[model samples]
Target chain A: MDAAFSEALIALLPNLRRFALSLTRRPDQADDLVQITVERAIAGAGSYDPDQRFEPWLFRIMRNAFIDQTRRRKTAGTQVDIHEMPEALPTDPGPGLEARLMLDSVRVAMAELPEGQREILHLVCVEEMSYAETARVLEIPVGTVMSRLSRARLALSEKLGIE
Target chain B: MQIDDETLMALADGELDPARADELRRLVARDPALQARLHRFEETRRLLAGLRLAPEGEDPLAAMIRGAVTPEAPALPPPANLNRPPWVALAASLAVAVLGLGWWQWSGRAPDGFAPAELAALDGLPSGEVRRLESGEELAMIASFRDGDGALCREYETSGGDLVRVVLACRDDGAWQQRFAAVTKADGGEYRPASGEGSIDEALAAIGAQGPLSLEEEEAVLRK
Candidate 1:
């Protein structure tokens, strides 16, 4: 691998970890997923198209790795519960305690969403991925991305009582 | 005209065409129910954006991957001047610059301290707004607050190349003085939730900062 590719992969570690956390929910599993994703990315770096954006390509790799891991875990009869207690949520004192609590609720509500909706919401709202990019990442139609993201937002709003 | 949820969501996310977005904006402005729906999308996005993941230290696997990628070197020395708390290093440089010290060779920094573009951002960029420079660097104003001395101060974040820096600058004697800064690796396009602790919290505590100013309050301060 070239220097640029290695550097980019290293820089994207935090993003990979966050996405993995969203997928696996457990921090330990999230770390393992990130490791697996980086290993796969490096192994397949030669196939990555230089002209395309790096993020969607990397994210696709992560999601695929997650699916593979889930299948293996299912066969072993050791599936991790999706509702595993969350680690202590981050508290941002800068935004004040009230806003911080509201954000905590947002995280809790997000966890309750359907897996498809949760992933799309994280991609669009938190990661700020464009609809086209999100579609590429999720392997879905752009229309599906829009409708899913819209539904996710509405679900979140209703959960939070934001009329 | 009835607007679909997808269209309203797209408008809220800034994914719609400019002309169509403008049209919807006008229509939504006239309808209270539409405004509420728009607010739902907007507020959800805002709250979600606030769900910034705190950075745990780099995993050991990263080192393993680094080793695999590098053919010649087993390990590279960590980037220089970053092992220590960045604000401590930045504070020294800021002190030097403030005392009319000789020019120091900090990359992307103006000789007088603030980059011309950064000064422009400090002057007017509202909290939560982001500006992209011609050089592909992105500047985001995080918030504004009053320091212990009641000076108006702003906290902003800048990312370019592979590094993101969060800085606090205060208005002093008709100029913005660089106060505190912390650096971290850029995680592609992820929304960086300013971590609660570490150097930023230390800076805030040392400065006796009250809290972030509201939009109206920040605007009032900027107007002066």
Candidate 2:
């Protein structure tokens, strides 16, 4: 985690944060997830192969961290209060308020999606990770990626009144 | 020919081979249903693109992170016994997973009880400092950041001999409040440093982030 590596992680932070937010559904948790992922990435930096795309490798760590964290929280019964909800992504509020509202509606709908589908949608649709890359990041089969992605899109479309 | 949702999705994502994609394009030129399905897929992609959070407010946590990730920063030790069966587990993950709580933290601050020295651990000092107190307890700052609600928190530990307390604390109204903590003794009466995933990571995920501290914000935290 030298300056160069820190710079590299910073450059990817926005995307990494975005992916984490999608998974965590809140900026704060996303930030923490990003922090934890960076910790795991930096700690496991020695294990990273320079040949692989760093993004997926980093994503894998976040996914694993999410799993590890989620399992523990379930056991502990910690309650995240209303204050912990993620702020909607800031959009131009003037002319785009209605559009933003509609988008907010979609965000609400996305939040309703099953964790698996939501994750697939975020990776494939939001981050635009290839289905192949997605499978690798999620440690799922490629076919499962396509099926889950299809379901996520259909569900979102239905919820958003897009038919 | 009936177009399956999967094929339409592939066409929209440009995942099909060029030959098949070109053929579909020709079909879509004439087939109203195919065109509608493709439009649906494209629109879904567009709507979902809004999922990315815009950096609007000051990310008060950025600087702490920037300070923390340096090569000089304490590395999160690789989980001990990764290959070993899961003996040690996290405290609570439901705060992040089961409740499915969307991101947002309540306004105002909660009360906390830890001493000032303990509270300072949340200030994002680069890790790896091993400070030994007069009591012969070793206190270390593993990492720091503000949770989703903007409260500063630290993943830290205090150790003396056979007993080690791994703790996660967040500053609530300027005092350290412990959200999660656990103590585990070394197996067979031998003391080894603790390493691996624990309550801290789980607690933070549930806590959420307002944003990372911007460099200036980190400076401000340091100034305080």
Candidate 3:
């Protein structure tokens, strides 16, 4: 692997892990998504345009991996049991407990959202992607991205009990 | 323009054009209720931003990477095709088991060993002594002191950079003991201990500004 590619991969790990966790709502699965994305990116390093923003390309790969997994699960007739998910770390006496509880509520709220809304929310809010970039990733118009984001935000605000 | 949800989101995200943003700003300034509503919406976004995405116990990315990197092992030879006898296979299995056990034993993941340098650096300082290390790093050494709960409390920073407030009390045998420990991030990012806080002349002033320290508590921690 090229040195630049390796450096980029390491730097992206934290954000990629965060994005994956948002999608899967489970640390292990999120890590799996990130790992798969990295492996695929590494394997197809030649296909990547060095001039472009590496994040969007990498996100596309992660989204594909997630879609593939979802399809596989659907075919296998097996559902992911949220309760069986592994813990992220040891429970420390700090903001960790409160953070975890809030995260649980957020995950539940996210799951209740429509798939399109969820994807757009992840891309825009979590990933901090622009509407144009989100449009490109979702292959939809920028108007659609804005609409989805507005709906997602309203739904999330209601779910989280924000006035 | 009557600022709707889309416009509010755009303004919050800084996606609005400068002229439109200025207009919205003027509107918000004129209307307190609109400003309050905008503030609540912004707060909701901030709260969501702070939410943890990863649950406890799992690292999905690590697992995924491990799965990708771990090459599939070559298929084992069929039992019928193997020329080795049952005794030979059993011996091989035992050898493999022994190797695995030895590897586990040699792994240095145990928490028993403390870094000698760090421990030594801590040792020279007196109880309640706030010393700046050679690297200009300052640390507070608090001794177990009696609190309202009648417990001895020794507060210190954990190795992980967390400020731990502990409550300790003297037991029946006269040994100062820890009652409870609460880990919290230091406010205002102030990790450096205040100077002149440990001296006898400044002890009263220090206690007034900071807090008290126990003599035995200092000795007990130094022994660690």
Candidate 4:
């Protein structure tokens, strides 16, 4: 139990929370996800290789926690009705009323994306991960990451009506 | 040749070789529809970047940390100072709301403004070592040789405020290359050199005090 591990975890909390929220959509669930991730990280601290970067390792844990939660929900026969979930806002609010409208539209469009596409979109595009890193995090092949990202972009362009 | 999605993604991520990229650029120049599609792909990436993380009010990380540290703590406590006047209570509630809003705005939750290029630059370093230096720190060169780690990691901070972290990993080829380097906000919001002498001497001294590097020792961890 190195003291610096706790400090590092604290520094990473904000980004972890954001990533969890994007994955879970619900605040309570996102918090739960983060909690589980922290516990797992703490328990497996010894397994953390010092050579690799910490953020990605932590992020991989967070992603696993999210997937595990989803799997548990599925096993319990609890299906999430995404239609009832609240939406995420625009990154930039821009000006006034127009900005608000744009945000609403963006939120709706984001909500309509499939979970797999949305996850890749958030990780690669929003988080700015390289394809190789994204593949490592998602446990998928690099080609899959490329194709998924391309599909996600195409869908978003259609939904946003971007020429 | 019109680039496929794979090639386009690689190009957009700057993963393509210069010659390949040049060939793609030539193709895009001659193809209107392909160019339009490429533009759309780029715009889509920008729009995704514009998708802000959920606002601060819903931060689960705080709750997660609290829960992990104090699993048996009580969930809620009785209201304190309940005898205050109604107006005071109202003001207090408003104040709490305002403080919450302000915290969300400034809680270091927003992006740290480190661009992908910066991260890429750090990744390009040889030893996988980088550091954040404090401003106005004395130029220092500290080399710590830990028993178990093969080569010594050299760290230093420049007067110009760059903190540099470097590890000389012994490769199979028996050559040492600079591994990791990053430019981050220093103690006074200045650049910290990743290695060398001057202001970074203090850190080097500390590492030197620790011991010499050994074959089994581990290098310092790099944080993004």
Give the top-scoring candidate (TM-score): 2
Q: How high is the DockQ of candidate 1? A: 0.23
Q: Write the per-residue lDDT of candidate 3 for residues B50-77, one digit (tens) a residue.
A: 5434344443334333332322334642
Q: Kindly report, for each predicted structure in the order presented, the TM-score of its chain A compared with the true chain A.
A: 0.90, 0.86, 0.81, 0.82
**Ten contiguous residues minimizing lDDT sum, candidate 4 chain B:** B95-104
The clash number for model 3 is 19
Model 3: fnat (fraction of native contacts): 0.16
Native contacts, share recovered per candidate: 0.57, 0.43, 0.16, 0.38
Tens digit per residue, CA lDDT, model 2, A1-163: 4555556666677778777866777666677777667655655655778787778888888998888767766776665532345454444454377777877777778877888988888888888888898999999898888878887898888888885
- Per-residue lDDT of model 4, residues A53-154, tens digit only: 777788899998788788767766654543465443224335478756765666567668888987888887777877888888889998899898889888
TM-scores of all candidate predictions against the true structure: 0.58, 0.59, 0.51, 0.53
Q: After superposition, how far is residue A23 of candidate 4 from its true place, in Å?
A: 1.9
Q: How much does each candidate deviate at the interface, measured as C-alpha RMSD after superposition?
A: 11.7, 6.4, 12.6, 11.9
10 residues in a row with least lDDT, candidate 1 chain A: A82-91
Q: Is candidate 2 or candidate 4 better by lDDT?
A: 2
DockQ of 3: 0.09
Q: Which segments of model 2 are wrong by more than 4 Å?
A: A26-28, A78-95, B57-224
Q: How well is each residue in B84-188 modelled by candidate 2, as lDDT tens digits?
A: 111112111111122121111211123234444555545544344456545567777555557877776656666666555566677778666777665544322
